[model samples]
Target: MENGTMPSYFYFTLFKDFVHMRYLILILTLTVYLAILLFNVIILFVVFKERSLHEPMYIRISCLSVNDLYGSAGFFPRLMVDLLFDTNTISRTACFVQIFTIYTFAVWEYTILTLMAYDRYVAICNPLKYHKIMNSKVTALYMALASLYAVFSMGLAIFFSARLPLCGTDIARLHCSNWSVVRLSCGNSTLNNNIIGFFVSATTVFLPAFFILYTYVRILIICQKISKEFRGKALQTCIPHIISFVNYSIASFCDIALSRYDSDKFKFVALFFSVGFLVIPPFLNPLIYGLNLPEIRKNIACLFQRSKVGHFPK
Candidate 1:
């Protein structure tokens, strides 16, 4: 070997260690994300295959499952690949696309959650009008509007973010989120931040939170006027929605906090919570609703029995 140069074996060992860590993180993330994805798919299948689950609440739950599946698939797989292969570099165009896709999925998720809250409000607080209010036409309109809003809002955010010239090397985070990319721009990002922040907060966070809260409050008032047995059932139906609201609140706050923070430690914590908040609720939502509502559980059991029988026979 040369006198001033290190041996090839030393470089090999260093590279091996880095590769080992990357592989470990990739495996862990893949396993977790796959489990979540599989559970969501199972919920979707069970809902669609079972004719009894064609009600408004279950339809909204199916929509939420679909949204969660797309949201996780959009970001987590690319993130895992980047982490595992040491392909930390992303082209400007790819980064903008990633940011746009992630934001679009996020907006859809919030809108669906709000729609679910409205569904519950109608079912519990105005049972007589539930069918008329959440009929096929209204459901279709809501879904179409939610899809359009997601695309439009994300397009605007991405357009503004992409217009800025990026000159920095340190992005600090694993994914190219809106604020992280904006913060790295060469020019002033104040205008972009203000516009994106206002829209995001108004549409995704504040509006949804307000509706969820308002719906639940109305449900509570209706429950009070009903018989004790009906009141108990109403409260039970609300438990899952309340849990989801809390999860959304935490995640929304964490998202905003991560955008505002410069500390790597806090950012990492916020990222972890954000991912947890997104993944756990979707998986848990079906389980919670199924256990509390006997019809869903019966349908799921029937589905499993049919699967087993089909596999066993000729």
Candidate 2:
């Protein structure tokens, strides 16, 4: 150690705390990660292969699945590696990349959910104009815009964070994030970085969140005046999305709230809560949405049956 100063790379202590249970946790973590990957891929394949499922609504669902996959990809590989080794350190460059990937995935998710809510609103509230409102070209455009905006928003945060001079490099968790890296900077730079980070979150996160809630509320108000059959259809379409939305929102809140409060009394809270957001959505979205939607489920059944037929030739 030079001058007893911090290193250029940051070390994580997330697994050290659970050394006795590391193997079990690793096994469980791998299982969950695999499940998430498999299910999301199945959803993507089903939607891609099924012609009937090519409608705008299912396209948005597929995009949501893609978002889950992207988010999981940003974390799981790195996490699994950390679990397999004693060293839990990440270089500054790699940390910033992870921050970009995970944050963009998160922001993209919020945007897509907002987009989906808007799609549903248009479809139900103005059924006659669903075609005009969510046309293929328009849906594609929205998805592209969501992705672009997410990257842009996250890029700004990472750029500002990179400008700060590091005074320490001891990140205290299972993974790296913008805040973790920013916290290492000294003095006024730290405050300015935090202000930028908070601004980005407000613009990219809370506003979209507000729009999602507003759209759903409007949908609910409109539902009250619609026919029972139409309301039923709307509910069926929305419930799965709503469940994922709530799951993600809760996990994100837990992570943000508990991140700075890492007292002895709250040991493991930050690690679990921070990682929970990444784990829950990817695994949960496919199971909930795939089964709940009839066409995708039917396509999945057909795919398996075809595999069976091919395997056992008469």
Candidate 3:
């Protein structure tokens, strides 16, 4: 080293390594997230435009897709920016807002999946009364209730998490999460952590998973008595919900575990699962529902063709 200068080789080597991997991760995240966003937008448009997709199942699917869109959109973009710039600083207010939005959408997603399970249970367990039971009014009420519950629960979680007075500004992760942020507080966080942990596990993990499993068991029992055609259709209808539920459950556990621990190894594992859960389900959802369902597939193809021709070519 010359004249108080640092070692060039060390700094340069680290910089090179970081630049290489950072670019790769950034590109990959952008491509995956943007592709999913584009597909989701297409699905939303198709559902809005096609009168045929106004049924209860598609309605629920649409809501779930929208939640996925918002959920991933909340955190991924910020992560991408931080990765590229090596800047992880976020304002306290911004952090709280992010926590609120992410938590709300996450809870909403779990609630939606639970409702979908109930939807399937009704459609399969009582085919004759499915229409009468899942009428628009009842469905609307369920949606409204789910939305309200998610908002209040997430609000309470945020309130408790935010109350811990900050001793310092250091955060370990790319973005502010309730757990990471709460660790910085000067006040006792045991109660806050317990409350958040309980609510998150109960609603997102236990309740939804239980309902899904119960519904599927009922579905299987019902399938044994129905015709082959009906059984096959019923199984297909439940497949997407099963996939979403499993993804959510795994991700929820990984996140809760990550929040509980401060180890770098655990954080890395948790990050992988968190991103996987967020991205995989959203990408899989359209393929599961749209590709398998004839109406949605046709509408998507038609929509693409019409877009290419530019509105009847004047």
lDDT of 1 by residue, 105-216 (tens): 7777778778888988888878899999999789989889878877887787777766665555455555567777666566455476667858766987688788888988
Query: Which candidate number maximizes TM-score?
Result: 2
Against the true structure, what is each candidate's TM-score? Answer: 0.86, 0.93, 0.86
lDDT of 3 at 177: 69
Worst 10 residues of 3 by lDDT: 5-14
Cα TM-score of candidate 2: 0.93
Q: Write the per-residue lDDT of candidate 2 for residues 49-154, one digit (tens) a residue.
A: 7788889888888888888888898898888787788567888778888888889888888888888889888887888999998899997888788778777878
Q: What is the C-alpha lDDT of each candidate?
A: 0.70, 0.82, 0.74
Position 92, candidate 3: lDDT: 66
- Top candidate on lDDT is 2
Measured with C-alpha atoms, the lDDT of residue 168 in candidate 2 is 79
lDDT of 3: 0.74
Relative to the true structure, candidate 1 reaches a TM of: 0.86
Q: Is candidate 2 or candidate 3 better by TM-score?
A: 2
- Candidate 1: clashing pairs of residues: none
Off by over 4 Å in 3: 1-20, 266-268, 305-314
